[model samples]
Target: MNDSADVSTSPDAPPVTIFGPDFPFAYDDWISHPSGIGAIGPEAYGQEVAIIGAGMAGMVAAYELMKIGLRPVVYEPNRIGGRLRSEPFVPGEPEVAELGGMRFPISSSSFYHYVNKFGLRTRPFPNPLTEAAGSTVVDMNGESLYARTLEDLPEIYAEIAAAWDNALERIAGFSQMQDAIARRDAPEIKRRWNQLVHDWDDRSFYDFLSTSDEFGKLSFRHRELFGQVGFGTGGWDSDFSNSMLEILRVVLTNCDTDQHLIVGGAEQVPRRLWSDTPYRITHWPVGTSLSSLHNGSPRAGVKAIRRADADHLEVVDSYGVAKQYKAVIVTCQAWLLTTEIDCEESLLSMDLWMALDRTRYMQSSKTFVMTDRPFWRDVDPATGREVMSMTLTDRLTRGTYLFDNGPDRPGVICLSYTWMTDSLKMLPHPVERRVELALRALDNIYPEVDIKSHIVGRPITVSWEADPSFLGAFKGSLPGHYRYNTRMYGHFIQDDLPAHQRGLFLAGDDVAFMPAWVEGAVQSGLNSVWGVMHHFGGQTPVDNPGPGDVYADIGPIDVGD
Candidate 1:
C-alpha cells in the first residue's frame, strides 16, 4: 500500500530525497557537480585498482575510477548487474523478468543520476495500492478485497494506515526529520538521527510497533493486518525482526514511497554504465569506457585476497592469476569474504571481522511468467472490476505484480515475490514447482480468472540465498547490529585504520546504512571511489569535496561497542 503520511508533492514543497539522516551528504549533488567527482595525481594515472564483482557498486566504482585516470580491473563470477538482474523470457525479446531490484524510489537521487546519465526511462512501479498498479487486491485470512485506492478498501485498512502514521510522528518525529532531510539540514538531521540511532538501534521493527501506544491501543489483529498490508509498499512482516532504525530510515527517506521501475529493466543502468563513455573524463582519451578498458569484459571471479605488502593488496582470480594493486574495492556481499573467498585474517581487525561475519542477510524469492497478453486488465462483467490486480496476500504468494508492456505485446507477471520464511518455502522448489505453488495461491484469490490459459512461456524463478555468490538477498540488520553497520559504512575512511586494512575498501548496499537500495550501493561505490583516490593522494576539487572530506563531522553515529 501507499504511505498516507507521504510528504506533500506540490510544486512548491521541497522534494523528499535520500539526503541521509546518517552521513547527511548530498551524493547526487556531489556527482552532478560541474567540477567532476575528483582528480588524482599523475602518478596514480593508469594504475590498476582491483574491483571485485561487476554489480552496480562495482560498475559504478569502476566507471568513476576509470573516468579519473585510474584503470579499474573488474572481476565477476556471475553476470553483471548483480541484484539488478533482468532476465528475458525469450532470447532477444523485450519481455523480461526483473529478478532482482525491480523497484526504484525517486528519493534514490544518486542512482537516478546514473539512470539520467544513461538516458534510461522509468515509470511508476505497479505497487499494491499505487495508481500504476491500476487496482490492488489485498487478501487476508481467506478474504479478498479489491481497491482502486486505499479509500476503496475497508475502514480497518485506513485505521491501520492512520495508526502507523501516528506512531511514526509520535515516536520518531517523522515529519520534522523528513523536513530536515528535505532542507538538507545536516546538523539538524544528525541531531535528530543520532538520538534515534542511540535509542532504537537495539530495537526491532516489531518492537517499535508493539510498544507504541497508538498500536497498543488497537487490537492484535490490527497489528497483524498492518504487517500483512503495510504502508508505502506491501507487507513488511518479513522485516519485523530487523532493526527499527533500518525501517525508520526507509520511511524517513521515502525509500518505499513514490517508487518507479526502470523501463526495459533495472539491469540496463549498470550495463550502460559499463559501456557508455563519459563526456567529461579526466585522463582517459575520448570514447574510452570500462568496456574498452577491460577489452569488452571483466576479469574472472576472484578466488582470494591477501596482503601482498604493507602498501599493496593482492587479488587472485579463478584462473589463478594474481596481481597486486595499491588499492582494491570489494563491492560483493560482506559474507562472501568468509565463504566465497579465502581472505587473509590480517586484512582486517578482529572487530571489523566480527562486524562482517555477524552481518545478517534476508532471504528473497521471486517467480515470473510471461503471458500472451495483459488479460488481467480485462474487466469482469459482474463486479465491473479488473479480472486481477497487483496482489498482496497472506498466502504463499505474498505479493503478485503485473507488468503490461503493451496491449498487443506479451506481458510479464511476477507471480510471487516473497521474503524470509515465505521465500524459504520456495527455495527447494524448481521453477515449475515454484510457478505451480504461486498459481495455486493466486487461484484462491481469483477463482474464475483462468490465469493458466494466458501463459505462453516457461516461468523463471530465483532464490538469492541459494546463490553461492550472494549468501542472501540483501543485508537486513538485526536488533543491536547498528555497531556493525557503523563499522562497515565508515571503513572507507581509512586514516585511522591499520596499514593492513588501509588499501582494501568495502562498497555495496550491504555496507551502506540503507541496504537493499541501489542508492546505497551507488553512494557506497562513490565512497570507495573517494577512498581509492585518496589512497593514491588524489584530491577532490575545492568546490566539490568528497564524502571522505566531510565524513568525520557527519558520519554514521557509533551506537556502542
Candidate 2:
C-alpha cells in the first residue's frame, strides 16, 4: 500500500514500474496462512502490554494480543478513534461527516478482513464520475462541465485517459503487474517491482508524467485537465513532487478505485472492538473487552517513556502517573514521538530516530456540513438534472464529496478536501469562515442552486496540520526516502534492533507500506503482534508462517540497493 509514481517511456521502450521497485509484500496472504501466526507459551500469557493511540493500528494489535491471553491497556488523550473520526453534526441523527478515513479501497483486504469479521455494512463511496457517486461536475478555468460518464467529458479528457493508460502500460506493464499482484506471485511481483524502485525511487510523480512520450505528445491543456480531473481518487497535483513510488503503490494496488465507506461511521470498527467480546482467551473472562481489561477508560496521553529497569519500561501519563510494563507499542504518529511525548534520548537508536524525525506528513483540510435533506438530489426543471453533484475543481474547494443518508433523512456533504498548500490556506480561518469560503466556491459552481438555504445545525471542519495530536493528515514521502521508509516499516523485527529498543515497537500507517491507507495500519499492527510474540518467546502455529519467518524469502528489496 505505497504511493504511485509516473515513469517515462514510449510504447516500444522498456516497461517501467509505477508504485516502486520495492516488493509490495502480500500481507493478506501472510495473515491468511492456515497455520495462523505464532503464539506465546502459557508462561508468558496474561502479561501487560501498553498500547498508545486507540486508532486502527492500536486497536487491531490490542485485539489480536487479547485473543492470545495478553492484557493490553490503550492510552488516548482524546476520543477512542484516532484518524477514523466521524462527527455527528446534529444531535439524534444518523447523518455524520467523516472527519477522517472516509473511503476504503477493496484492494485493502487486510482492512476488510476486520470489517467483514465484525459484519460492518458498507456502501460504494461516491467518487468523481463513478455511478456510485451519482453525477460529477468538473469546473475548471471558469467553465463548468457535467458528466454522467467518462464519455460526457470533452474529447480532451479521453485523450488524457489514453495517454495515462499508455504511460502506465508501456512504462510499467500496469495490467500485468496488477495480475501478478492479484495472483500473489511474490517472485514475479518482486522482480518487476524492484526494478521500478531502483529507477524511480528518486523521481517525482510529476517528473514521471512530464518525461513520458505519451504525455509529451499531448497539449499542456490536456495535462492540466488530467491533473484537475484525476482518475479513481481525483486531482493529485498536490502530490506532484511526491516520490513516484507513493503514487505507484496507490494505483498498482488498486487502492485508488473500487472503494467503499463503512455504514454509520468508520470509527465504530475500533469503538466496537473496545467493548465487543468476540472470543475467549485464558486468564480473562469469556466476555472480556479492552475497556474491561483496562478497568474502564484508557489512560490520558503519555507524557514520557523511559527505561525503568533492564527488563521493563516506565510510561508516565499526563497526570504524572507512572506505570511499568514489560513492553510498549507506540501507534501514534511518528512526529508525536519527538514533539508531544518526552522520550529518553537513548530510548531509540539514532537510525530509528532519524527515520521518525524525517517523516514528512501532508497537510489536509476537510469541511463538512449537514443538510436537512438530500437537497443536492433535487432536479432542476429547467436543466433536467440535479442541481449540484459531486464536485471536482481547481478552485479553493478542490474535491467535494456528497453523502445521502436516505430519501427523507438528512445528508452530509464534504464541502472541501484540500491538500498541501490548498489545505494550508484555511489554517487561519475558523470553522464558520471555512464553511463560508466553501459555500462561496460552491455558489460559483452552481449559481442557480441556493445551497445555504438547506444548512442545518452547525458545520464541522478540521485542519489536521493544526491538530497537535495527529500533527498532519498522513505521511507523504518525498523522493529518495525509500530507505528511511523501509527502516520504519520493518522496525518490528526486534532481532535487528539494539537491546534498548527491543521492547519498544512501532505500528501505524506511517510505519506501513501503504502510508495513508487503513490496510497499512492493519498490516503494521499484525506485524507488531508477530514481533511482540517473538520477543516473549511465543511461536506461531507451524502451519501459519509469520511475516518474519518468510521475510528472508519475500521481504521488500533493501532500499539501500
Candidate 3:
C-alpha cells in the first residue's frame, strides 16, 4: 500500500518558463480538481483529527479535512484568524485596524481562492504613494517631501530605483528567474533560485545592497534615502539584517505589489470558514461545519503533546484536559512548541527541534487611531496641498496608512507599523502613550495639520512579540538558516519519518516558502491535507498533483549545496 502518488512528465513537455515571475505554484489546479485529494476508506472516515490553533492554517486544514470526510477538532486559546487579526476601533462598525496582516498581494492565488469563494470584498491597499493610497509623504531628518507618483520624487529617487533593478539583474538573473517562476518551470526556478540561495543564503540584505556595484557607485546618502523610501510598502531598513533570500522571495513572487486589503476585515475569511458549510462528507450532514463538529466552540489551547501510543498521540489543553487522536496537526507558531507549550522532547526529532528552536521572529508593533473623518485628505488653505499624506518616515512612527470609510463615517489610520528595535522601544509603553508618541512624530512631519483634533475613538495598539500564543510577529529567517527552513518546510511529507513520528504534522506560514503571507499559510495547509490523506491510506487523483508529488519530480531548492 504505497501512499506515494507518482506523477509522470511527458518527454516532449516544453520548458516551464511561461508563468511569469509570480510564485509558480498552481494551487488553483488542485482546489478545482474533481475527486479532491484522494479519499480515505470508511474506517478512517469521520475519525477525529486534532488541529491546534484556529488561525488561517488550522482553519483551512480543518475545512478541507471536513470536506474529505474527516472530523478536525481545532483548539485555539485566542480569537480566530491568528496573525490575520483585524480589531475594530468602534464595535459593530466597518472602521477597523489590521493588528496583524494588513495587505495581501494579488499573486497569492491560494489565499484569494478562499477570499473569492467566501464572497469577501477587497480594496487596493495604499502602499506608500500608490494611486489608491492618494498621496505619500516621506519624512527624513526634519525634511519632508510629498509625492503623488514616483516621478514626483526627486530625480535621485529614480536613480535609486534603477540601481536596485540593475543590482537584481546583475546578481540574480532577474528576468530569467521571473520568467521561470511565471511558467512554473521547476527546474529553471530551482537552478536560478538555488544559485541565489547558495550565494546569498549567508549574506545580509544590507550587505547585498551595499556591495552591489550599482548601489556602490551612489553616495551613502543615496543609500540612506533608498532605505527611507523603500519600494512596495514603506521603509525596509528593518529587514536590512535579514537574509537576502527573504527579500528576494518577496520581490520575485510579487508579494509586495498590486496588494489589496480585505474590505470588511481579514478576520472574515477564517470566521466564515468556522461555520460555513461548503461540502459534506461521510458522517457530517450536508450543512455540517467546523463549529458543529466542535459543538460550537474551539477546544482550549494545547498545553502539551505526548506520544500516547505508537498509533496515536495525546494532546493536553491549557485546562489540563488531555485528548487522544490518531493524527494531530500543529499549526501554531513554530516557537510555541518550546515557549508556550510543554511538549515532550521526543515528539519531534532533535534535528526538528533545532529547526524550531533556531527559528527567528522579527518583532512588530502597530498603533492605530480612529479619526472622525478622512482628515488627511483635507487641503491646506495657504499651501494648496494635502494637509497630511499617507506617511513613511525614519522617525519612531515608521509607516502610516489611512483607511477612509467615506466622508461621513469614521476612518482608521494606522499611525505606525514599526519593526525590530523600533518595535521594542514601544513594547513597555501603554496604548495611549504609544499613540501620543506616534502623534508627536506625525506632528514633526505635519506641523500645519492638527491630527490629534481629528482623532475620535481610543487608539488601538499591538506588540505581536508580547502575545504569549505568538511569540513574535512572523518568521524572519536570518542568513544561513536555509537548511533549517528546508527541514521545516518539507515536514509535511512524512514518508521518511519514523512510524511513531508520522502522525503529528506541521503547517503554517512559518513552514512555507514565503512566510508572513496568508497564501503561504493556505498552501501549507493544503500540503498538510495531502500528507494527512496519504498517511490514512489515501491517494491523490492522477490529474491533480500534490506538493509532495511535485517536489518529488522537481525538488526544493537545494540551498545546503
Candidate 4:
C-alpha cells in the first residue's frame, strides 16, 4: 500500500510531491482550529492590537483583526514568519532557511491556507527515490531494523495491502472525528471528545498501542518509517501536552485544504504584511532576558524599564527606539508570556509556573547548505548504491525536511523541520563546532552530497532553543491544561481589570488553540484582538489596527516578578 500510495508522477516534477508517505504538507488545508472556528474581536473600532510574531499564527490574527475592524500594529524584532529564512550567500547562491521550525504536513489544513495566501509555490522536494537513500536508527544486531526497501524488511509492513489501508483509514477517521467535534456546539459531546483527547494526552501513542502486542510492535516499527518519510518525533512519547494533540490534528488535516508558501520564502510573507500595514514593525534588541514593568495599574498605563541588553520584552532597542503601544499582542510563544515577561507575581499562579517548568523542551539546529552547483550527485552517501527521490523506480525517504520548493532551486534546503530543537542542549560546540557536526550529520544522510568540500559559503546556524529572541521552538500545554483554571483569555478578557488596555496582549502559541502549531499563534493574535476589542466594550473600531491604537494583549501571561 505504501508503494501504491506513492502515486506515479511526471518526469519533470519532484518525485515525492505527487503522493505517499513522503509527500510534504499542502498549503490549502483549512483546519477547524479554535481560532479558525470563531474569530475573536472588537465590539467597536480604532482599537490597537499588537501582534508580536510574524509567523502563520500572527498573520492569521492580523487578517482576522482586520476583518473585525481592529487596528493591529505588529512588532517584530527580526524578520517576520518567526523562524522562516532565506538568504543569498555567494551573491548568486540563493538558499531558503528555517532558523526555527519548518516543514508542512501535506494533510494539514491551516498550513494549506497560508501557502495559498502567500502564493508561494509548493513543489515536491527530493526524496530518497530521486536522490540516494539516507540513514536513520537501527539496532546493533539489526534485528529491529526499519528499512525503506521492502526487499530487506519484515513481512508485516509488506502486508501493505491490509496494514497500510487500515492505518491510513484510521488516521483519516481520526481527522473527521476531530473536525466534527470542532464544529459542534454541544457541551456534552465536546466533554466526551475532550475526555478522549485528555486520556490520550497523558501517555505516548506507544502506550495506547500497547493494548495490543501487534500494535505495540507495529507502532515502534512504524515510528522508524516516520523518519523515512520525515514526520520525526516529539515529546508525545512520555506524556503529550494539550498543545501537542492540537498540533497532531492540524498536521493530519493539511492534505484537505489550501495553505500557500509565500514566493521568495516565508520571511517575505510577514514582511509584506508589515509593509502593507499602516503601522510600523521595527526590530528592537528583544531577546529572552527579563525586563521590568513600572508605574503599571488599572487607571494609568503601564510603564517599563526598557533596556537594550535585556533579551526579554525590552520594549526598547539599543538604538534608543523605545516606543509605546495602546495595546500590545505578543505573538511569540505562550511560554514567553510565562517566563520572559516582567510583571506582578500575582498575575499567574505559582502552581501554574511550576507545572509548566516540568515539561522538557527539546532542541534542534537548522542549517542549510545551498551551493552554486548541486554537488550531491557525484558522491553517494548510503551503505550501498541507490538513487534518491528523483527516479521513478528508486529508493524513497526523507529530504531536507522541506516538502517542496520551486524547481529552479534544485538542491535540498532543510528548514525548521530539521528538528534540532531538542538536540541543541546536547550540541557541545560553538557556532563553528556546531556547523562541523551538522555537516557531518548531513553527509551521513546524503553521502552523495558533500558540504564541507563543495560548500560555497558559511552554513547559517540558528539555535531556536538557544536564541535569546526565541527560547523554544513552540508553545506547549501539558495534560489537563485548562484555560478556565488559568482565567485564560476566554475569561480574562471579560474581567473588569484596569490592565485590559494598558497595551498588553499576548499573541503567542497560547492565545488560542494554545498548543496547536502555527495555528495557535494566528489564533492568539485574534484572541488578543478580541481581548482588546472587548476591553473597550465597543468604544473602538473593530477593524485593522491603526497608529492611534493602544492596547496590549498579555492578561494571562506569567512572567517572573
Candidate 5:
C-alpha cells in the first residue's frame, strides 16, 4: 500500500525489524535465548501473581511468569483475546471476521516469536496496491480510478507520492534513521530520534505535513490525496491530530509495511500461549501449562484492586471473591482504571494517574460478510477488468477488502473498515443497517455488480468504542503527550518509586512507545515479567540482561515536564 518511491536498500544491508529507536533493545533475541528470560528464588515458587486481563500483553506476562515458577491468576471480563478478536462468521466455521489487529507487519519479531512457537501460519494481507490485493480502486469527489501498482495510477498521484517521500527525507531524515535501526546502532538511533522527540513532541501529523517545504509547494488537493491514501495503508486523516512523533515512530519502525495475517486468526496466538506448555519450565512438572494451572479457564473479571498490607495487594473479582498476591500486573486499557475498576488511589503516584487519565484512545469499526463464492475474481466482459478490487474511497464505507478462500470454499468480504469520525457515523447503526449502508456505498462504485445476490449468511460488525470493556480500539497519542507516554512506559522500572507503588506493574500497547501494534504489547509484557521477577528477588542470567537491567543506559529519553 506504500505510495512512496521504492527506496531500495543495498543488497547486503541487514533487513530492518522493529528494533526500537526509543529503547533499542533486542526483545526478540532475548526471548529466544536458551538460558530463559530470568529466574526467581525458590521461595517465590508457586507464589500467586494477579494478572488483570487475558489479552496478548497479559497472556505473555502470565505465560512467562508461569515458566519462571510463579502462579499467574488470570482474570478476564470477556473472551481470551482482547483486541486480537477473531469471531467466526458462522459458529464452528473456520472462516472468521478479524474485528481487531488484523494486519501484522513482519518487523514485529517479538510478536512473531510467539506465533512461531504456536506454529500459526501467516499469509500476505490483502492491503490496497499490494500483490495480494491484486488491484486497487481509489474513489474521491465522485471520481474513480483503478490501479494495479503505483505506476498504473495517474501522474497526480505519483506527484503526491513523491512529495511525501521528499517531506520525510527533508524534515525527518527518514532514510538515515531507518538505516540506524536496521543496523542496530543504539547510539546513532538515540542521537537522531531524541532530536525528533524534542522537536516534534508538541506538533501534530497535520502540522508536519502542512509545514513541510515539499508539501507547501504542492496544492491542497495533494495533501488531501495523501491523507485519503496514505503510504503503506489506507486513510490516515483520522490520525491528523495525533503527535508527529507518534507517526514518525511508526514509519521508522516499519510498522506499516510488508504485513501478514495469521492463518486462523490473530486470537490463536494468545489462546495457544495460554494452553501451550513451555519446552523448559522451572518448578512446574512436565506438560504443565497456564491452562492446567487454572483448571482450563481464567478467573472471573476483576472489579477492584487495593493494597491489603505492606507486603501484599488484594484483587476482588466480579463474583465478590478476594485474593491477595505479592505482585500484580495490570494489562487492561489505561482508561479502565478509572471507569471499570474501583482502584485504590494510593496504589500509584499522582503523576502516574494523570498519565493514565490523559491517554487518548481512537475509535474503530469493521463490517464483514460471507459470500457463496469468490465472485469478485470474475472479470467484467464489458470493461475487461475484475468486478471489484481492494478499495479506498471518500464515501462512508472508507475501505473495503476481499478475502478469497479456495475455489470451492465460501469467500469473505470486509465491507467496511473505518476509524475516528467515519467509525462514529456507524456507531448508531446495527449490523443489518451497517451492511445496508456499506452495500449502498459499494453499489455507487460497482453499479453493474449485484453484490447482494452472492450473500451466503449473516453479517458481522463491531464498534470498539461502544464496548464498555474497551472504551476505544487503541491508544493514539495526541500532540504534547510524549511525557505521559514516557511516564507510563517507564513505570516498570520501580527502583525510584515509593513503597506503595513497588509491587504493581503495567504492560500493554498503550504503555509502549509504539501503540496500536502487537510488538509493543509483547515487549511491554516482557518488561513486566522482568519487573515481577525483580520484585520477587530474581535476576536475568548475566548473559541476557532484561529491559530493566539496561534501562538507565538505553531507555527512552525524558523529554521533560
Candidate 6:
C-alpha cells in the first residue's frame, strides 16, 4: 500500500482516498508462508487461489478462503471494492467524493462476515417513515409532483398500499410452491414466476403489475411506484424478468446477521478486511477498465486498460509484472468485466451469449448533493415530528438517498436519484452530465438558493456503473435467469485442468445468481473458493456442498407456500 493516498485534485486540496493507520499488516513469504498473515495457508487448499476485483465479494471470499487454509492471491486494477470508491474533496483542490453503492440494505451472510471481521464502526440506518418530495421531481408521466409520507400521500395511493399489503399476503403465500417448482424445470418455474409473481423478462413493471393482486389493489401506486418510482418501466419491460420481485423479498428481507451502517462509510469494511492479510493492496487512480479474457488451459488470461493507456491486468501488462494467480476470482460488475475480457467465438456462441445477455446490469443516472447544512431537517413523514435521519430520502428525493454518503462520500449528506433501465443509458457523459444532473436536481429542491454554495464539492454524477471498469451500479435478475447462469457458468473448474496444467477457476456476482449486487457477488465468489478447494481434494470440503445453493447453505430457503 502506498503512503501518499490515491486521490484526485481540482486546483484544490484533495480529500484522501485512503487514510488511517499505516499498513499495519505484515507481508512475509505470503506466496509460501501462507499462514503468516491471514487465517489460511497456501497448501491448505492444496494449491494457491487468486481473486480478481477486490470489491466486497472478492475481499470477503479472500477472507473465507484464507480462514479455510487457502492462500488466495487477489488481483485488483485500482482500489478494492471496485465501485465502493470514495474520492476526496479537499478545499481548494480537486472535487472528490464517496461513491457508495447507494446505501446498503441488510446484507447477506457473506457480506456480514467481511464487515464484522474488519470491526468497522457502526451507525443506525433505520427504515424511512417520512420524506419530502420536491416540486422539481417528475411523476409517472414525467410531470412534476410533491409528496411527503405514505399517509400524507394521495389518499388513493394510501389505499393502494393497503391493498398491496393484502394482495401481497395472498400472493407471497404461494411463493413456497413456486420455489420448489422453479428448481425442477424452467417452463414450470417460468409459469409461476411470470403469471403469479410477474412476467418481468418480457414485460414492463406496468404489464406485470396488473398480473398481481397487490398491483391490482394498488393500481394507482403501481402506475407510479413500479412504473416511474422504483424499477422504472422501460428496462423492466424491455429487458428484465418477473423473478426480481420475489427474489428481492428474499434479498431485502433477510440478512446473515443484524444490519447497521458503517460509521465512516463502506470503505472501512474492505480496508479492515485487507488487514493482517499477506497480499498488499496498492490503491490507484480512477482508471481501471478490462480488455480481454483468454483461457490458458487452467489459467484464464485477462487484459485491462488503465488511465495512462497502461495495461490493467497481467495479460495487458508486459513482462507479466502484474501478479499471476493459479486461480482468479473476478469481483467487478460482470458487464465491466465483459468489456475488457474477450469472449472467444466459442464462449460467445449463441447459446452462451444469449445467457450472458440475460445477465446484464441495470443503468442509473444519479447525483450526490453534499452540504454543510443540516439538509434532512424537514418534517418527518413517518411521524409528523422533527426528523433527523432515516431512509425516507426516497420521499424527499423521489426514491433517491439523502442521508450522509456511501463509502464514496464519508460523513457528508448526499441526495441520490437514479433512473432504472434504459432511461439511465440515455444520460450524457460524466464530466458534463454528472455535475449538471446534480445541479439540476439541487435547483429543484433548493429552488432559488444557489445550492452550490454549501458545496464543499462532490463528483455529483459519478457514473461508476457506466464506467468500463463497472458496467452498472449493481446486477438485477429477470425471471428464471439464475437457472441457466449458475448451472451453466462456473462450470470451468480448476480441477478440470489438464494433468500438468496450472489454472484457477473464477466466479463472482456475474458468474451466477442472475443478479450481480453485493449478495450475489459474495455468494458466487464464495462458491469459487470452495470450487477451487474442492478441485484439490477431488471433492468439496466437509462444510460446504458444490453448486453453492443458498438453500443449501441454510437447508433450503423456506417458500412459506
- lDDT, candidate 5, 469-519, per-residue tens: 899999999998988988899989998998988899999999998899999
- Regions more than 4 Å wrong, model 5: 3-11
lDDT against the true structure, per candidate, is 0.91, 0.84, 0.83, 0.40, 0.91, 0.43
User: For candidate 3, lDDT tens digit of each residue in 1-561?
Assistant: 000110112465332221212134577567767757667778888898999998999999999888888899899998889998989877888888899998988777778888998899999998886888888888888889989888898888888888888888889887667656656776778777767777888999999999999999999987897777778787778889889988888877667777899998999999998989876455578889898888899999999999999888999999999999988999999999988888888877898899989989989999999988998788889878878788889999989888888998898899998999999999999999999999999888888778899988788999999999998899988998888888887888888888778888999999876889888888888878888888888777887777777765555665444
TM-score each candidate: 0.99, 0.95, 0.95, 0.63, 0.99, 0.65
- Model 2 C-alpha lDDT per residue in residues 1-561, reported as the tens digit of each score: 012332222455332222222535555655566555556788988998999999999998898888777889898989988999988876555678888899998777777777887899999999987888889999999999999878888988878888887798888888777766665667888888888888889999989899999999988888787777788879878889899888878888777877899998899888887887855455577888898888879989998999998889899999999999888999999999889999887878888799899999999999998888889899999889998899999899999899998887888889999999999999999999999999999899999888899988899999998998998999998998888888887888878666877788899999986888898888889888888888888887776677777776777788665
Q: Per-residue lDDT of 11-31 in model 4, one digit per residue for the tens?
A: 552222211111111112212
> For candidate 5, which ten residues in a row score worst on lDDT?
1-10
Model 1, span 1-561: residue lDDT tens? 555555656678788998988899999999899999889889779999999999999999999999999999999998889999999989888788999999999999999999988788899998888889999988999999888888998998888888889989988999889888988999999999999988898899999989999889889999999888886689889999999999999999899998999988899999998999888887899899999998998899999999998888999999899999999999999999999999999988898899999999999999999999999999999989889999999999999999999998999999999999999999999999988999999999999999999999889999999999998999999988988888899899999887778899999999999999999999999999999999999999999999999998998876655
* C-alpha lDDT of candidate 3 relative to the true structure: 0.83
RMSD of each: 1.0, 4.2, 5.8, 10.3, 1.1, 12.7
Scored against the true structure, residue 40 in model 6 reaches a CA lDDT of 28
Question: Candidate 4 local accuracy as lDDT?
Answer: 0.40
Backbone steric clashes in candidate 5, count: 1
Model 6 lDDT, full chain set: 0.43
lDDT of 3 at 518: 86
Off by over 4 Å in 1: none
